[model samples]
Target chain A: MNTKTRDTLGKVGVFALASVPLLDGIWRVTSGTRLGGNPIETLEHLSGQWALYLLAITLALTPLRTLFGWRWQLKLRRMLGLFAAFYALVHVVCYVWLDLGFAWDEIGTELIGRPTITIGAVAALGLLVLALTSPRAAVRRLGKRWQPLHRSVYLIAVMAVVHVAWKGKDGGEDALVYALVLIALLLPRFAVLAKKRSSPQA
Target chain B: MMRKAISSNEITPESVFLKRRQVLQAAMALGAGSLVGCSVDSAEADTPSAATTRALTSTGSTDFAGGENWTPEKLVTSYNNFYELGLDKGDPAKNADWLKTDGWTVEVGGACAKPGTFAVEDLVNFNALEERVYRLRCVEAWSMVVPWLGVPLGDMLKRFEPTSNAKYVRFDTVLDPDNLKGQRSSILQWPYTEGLRIDEAMHPLSFMAVGLYGKTLPAQNGAPLRLVMPWKYGYKSIKSIVKIEFVEEQPDTSWNLSAPHEYGFYSNVNPSVSHPRWSQARERRIDGNVLSAKIDTQMFNGYADEVASLYTGMDLSKSF
Candidate 1:
């Protein structure tokens, strides 16, 4: 396809891929199929899982571009990050409003008392910062600092995994799967860091 | 004369009963589809054992207005929290089909006058089976009101005549890996054990449940026998009890041992005592109304009137 056609197709592909989870959630709610017995918990889990999945996808873009020379994958990173942040926002809202019954007192108690909640809150806050500054104007204004500030995705990814694992009723079997994915995504970054440290650039 | 009563109640012939069970089993298996996970050998015709005891009628009181607007039986049965079967709510209903409870015995020992293993039937036959409606509050902030058919645990335990030294009562659940899949995993130390204070054990509200809604307890719902401490969290009420021991000191419990910080020894339904991970102030009623708001959890799950005095001197927040 031509440059204009490729751009249009790429945007279309991103939109369709991103909307799949949200649409599936809506369909489940409407059809009364896969939401399980507890709809609130089902919705919460679905949104949270999608958020993690999108975040992982966002992180994978850099590695994919470097390894395969697929420069086009970089264009979709912004959309994936925003979607991850959006779903994460949904996750937090669902916990506070649907699960907690908008009990601000209880939410406050959870934020302070529970490590899982505290870690999740911190991750959500980081995502919020990235999402807010994702616009072209904000990125341009931030200049060189934008790249460093946005790298907090690494920290957010770790916190997300820890939050789920720590709050698991049984052992962290479900969390372990996500943790493995995040580790794989971070491996390339670690290798690059190691190389930079080894080379005598000075 | 007793034979006539038994024969009259169990009118269907053994062949017919087996056929009906097969039909029901097939229907359940089909309805559940892939969710059941484990397969029961379709070729083998499993019998409900010769020792399958009937639920005897009792003159016990059914005057409980506490559990109003009862949760539907479907929700209650389908959504179980039996960790023995699996972690998922539906896992028990799906996976517990292979569980054979007919040939079961419970060993009651330690500080009791009668310290011997007894048939499960004999234990049920000995007690007057009463129907009691109780609200079960789970530590996960979910609640269910179930009409359980059984006897007062106090009445049943007292028959054995506990020694004065028996300060606590420890109950152990069945640990067969063939039925209890979770038993294979060391998820909270195998052979799940729960305990109650001697006084708590003898409380009028505490029950030894064998059935729900006029039917014998389903395999998933702790068939044969299970302890029902309605005022406390559901975990306190251990399922498929295999052993009961009366000891001088406080007995070690499963959940408390699993995570001391999360699950306390006295897992009473207290709204004030927040679980390290979640708040206990409110609970979602699992009655198919997921969209509706959560109800404020009552102190002692609305059994404070009956069980509150039991914990009067103790600081529940610290003990929890």
Candidate 2:
């Protein structure tokens, strides 16, 4: 296949893969198949898991580009990051709308009083900022500031892990796996930074 | 309101019970019916077994006067936190069929005069079973109202003859790693254990449930026998109990051993004391609706009237 056709197909594939959970969630709501007894919790868990999975995949892209010199992978990073943000937004909406039934007073209390909720809200906010500034125009305007701002994804990822671990009932095995993945992705970048700093030329 | 004793004739046939559940579910979907006036039936339609399908006789006992609707039987059976089966709420119902509850035995020892092994059938039929609708508040900030049929725990403990040194009661789950999939993973210490002060154990409200919704308890809902302390967090009420030890000192509890800062021996449902991770102020009720608003968690899960005097001099926040 030609480069143009392959690229178009690749983008379509990414979009379709990312859209699966959301579409499944909709189908579950409509048809009530595999929604389990507690539909709200099912959807809440579904969206939150997809968001974390996408965020982890998005973070992994950078390390893959650095290690394999695959420049084409960078083209998908923004779209993947934005999809993560979209799911994160859906997760919060499920919490506020379906879980809490839009009780504004309870929502305020949960945001402020619950540690896990607070940490999750902050991570969602960080993702929101990253999503808003992901456009080409904003990238040019921010220039030097963009890299540092986007680097906050590391902090957001840590918060997400903490949020999940804290909320889990049985010891946080899921969170541990995510933590290990994040560490693996971050280790190569830190090694390169260390090498650059320790060089005699510097 | 006086409740009539459930007669053997009133027992729902398996087919009719399953059909009624489906109709109730449809009515709920149409938003035309609340869970009020719904009768008990076998919950496990997927796993049809003679043991789980058996019906039990239950006379209604004291329940919350607040008129909170019973959480649908499907949710009560499906949504569980039996770590022995799995971590997720739905895991228990799916995986608990592997558990062998027939001819189960519980060993009564440690500071008891008549320390002996008793079969589950003898233990459950030892005293008349009474159905008590209770508010089960989990530390995870979720709640459910369940109709549990069993005798008071104190009634059965008295038969074991707890000695003077029996200051506390420790309950342990069956430790079968080969059968219980969650036991293979070290997420929690094997054979989950829980304890209660002697007084707490003997409290009139502390129930030993053998059945729910007028049917024999499903394996997922802690079949054979389980404790139901309405005033404490749901974890305080251990499931699939195989051992009951009466000890002098406060025995080690699974949650407290796992996270001391978050879970204490006396995990009474107190809204004032927040868990290190989450707020205890409000809890999402597992009613049929996915969009139900969360309700304010009550002090002692609304059993304060009967159980508050038990903790009269102690600080609940510290103990929590």
Candidate 3:
């Protein structure tokens, strides 16, 4: 009904959804099953799925609010965005720890050698900036500048989708479905932004 | 078509079999997936009809006198990469317990005068393994030498008499997304589905294998049951099968539907035909020790003479 009510629901949904992947990660580890299909490919894919889910969930909040005109939807944006960041962080941890074996040199090699890994790293870097700016103090300090910094999530979303599309050994229906959902969630916002930019301010 | 057994320079002398211990120590140089287990150790023990896994360096001979001389380490790890069981080469070995084969049955419905489901044990005996060393290849461009033991699929199919109209045969694997976490991800379809032309299903070389390396099938490796089509890519042979539906029209396969640009239903092994993204010409062999120099892959996993007639006129590259 109201923005606050929508925000509460959105917050619950995001947190609960976030916990599923976390629980899955923990269960897999505890069960002694490595992530993904094969051993060599597991941790990275698990991390990637988390990162992809976070970005998608973050992108989804606004359209969800608009579609139903729920005011509370606005309140949960921060939580969803943070969850995206959380998954992205786990993705990074998996890549750094299990995949690269915490070898900085190997990390650098993956970042340089693979275009998907490179784009993913850049997206993570952008999210890092946004995460730091997410705090009230930085938002208050940057004022007008903070808004632009956060908008980078849009780029992060696009890059994240492309990274999976390009790097996936398969076409990755998992990646494709996430991309489609993210697009459905974000397209209306894009049209609104385009309209505002094009129309002359009265 | 039943293949004529031709005596080639292929079968080695009896003396080499007797002195295998001295010649195989240096063999560890091969890579993983080099062989899928039919070794002197796990695949076949020191029984009267068994072969020993001598280290390649233990003896100066780089070659074996009989069918390909593969080690146990190579045999256990080298053969069969069925994704329907799980995604990884090892996933089949790790998480295949959820697959129920005890009450498993195949649907003999398509063209049979009296179509019905037949229990697995009633259909074929699992105790005996028909050992034939063959080349195993993957669509991903890897190969291994395997001494396979099993019966012909056609032999089993013949038990169910067809009245006609059976153009295609489909195999369905057990689908519990909880156990098959990879299926839960929607990479391919949740329950994997694959098919073959009725003739292909009835080919002599197509064997439904229940075990490798002389023991019962391991849980991780499609366990209770799996198929072995030496002439086709690993995927063509379905694993952990629960249902075998015989149909009139062609069936939709999981990989072909998921990515049509890749994965054709006719996934025959041909070195000349390359996949859109990768080469099928060379293979990385996994013999469990050396991890390198496994050797180049041959056409049809070297079973072409027996199966070439299956695809006489069709362009393999385009079909692939």
Score each candidate by Cα lDDT.
0.80, 0.82, 0.63
Q: Assess the local accuracy of residue A41 in candidate 2 as a C-alpha lDDT between 0 and 100.
A: 76
User: Could you estimate the TM-score for every candidate?
Assistant: 0.84, 0.88, 0.54
Candidate 3 or 2, higher lDDT: 2
- Candidate 1 stretches with Cα past 4 Å from truth are A1-11, A32-34, A65-72, B1-67
The residue-by-residue lDDT of candidate 2 on B1-320, one tens digit each, is 33446643348765665567567656554442132122221222233334455778765565653666777777788788887887777778767676788678999999988998989877777347897888889998888888888998998899989999999999999999888888988877878999999999998889999888777788888988999998999999899999999999999999899889989999999999988766788888876456667788889999888999999899888988
lDDT of 3: 0.63
* Candidate 2 structure quality by residue, lDDT tens digits, A121-151: 9999999999999999999999999999999
CA error at residue A171 for candidate 3, angstroms: 6.0
Whole-model alpha-carbon lDDT for candidate 2? 0.82
lDDT of 1 by residue, A1-202 (tens): 7987897799888988788777766755685544445678767887898899899999999988666778877888899999999999989988888888888887888899989999999999899999999999999999999999999899999999998888657637678788999999999888888889989875
Instruction: Give the C-alpha interface root-mean-square deviation per candidate.
Output: 7.4, 6.8, 10.2
Of the two candidates 1 and 2, the one with more favorable TM-score, higher being better, is 2
| Candidate with maximal lDDT | 2
Question: Hey, what RMSD does candidate 3 come out at?
Answer: 13.5
The candidates' DockQ values read 0.23, 0.35, 0.05
List candidate 3 segments past 4 Å from native.
Answer: A1-202, B1-89, B176-183, B287-295
Task: Sort by TM-score, best first.
Answer: 2, 1, 3
TM-score of 3: 0.54
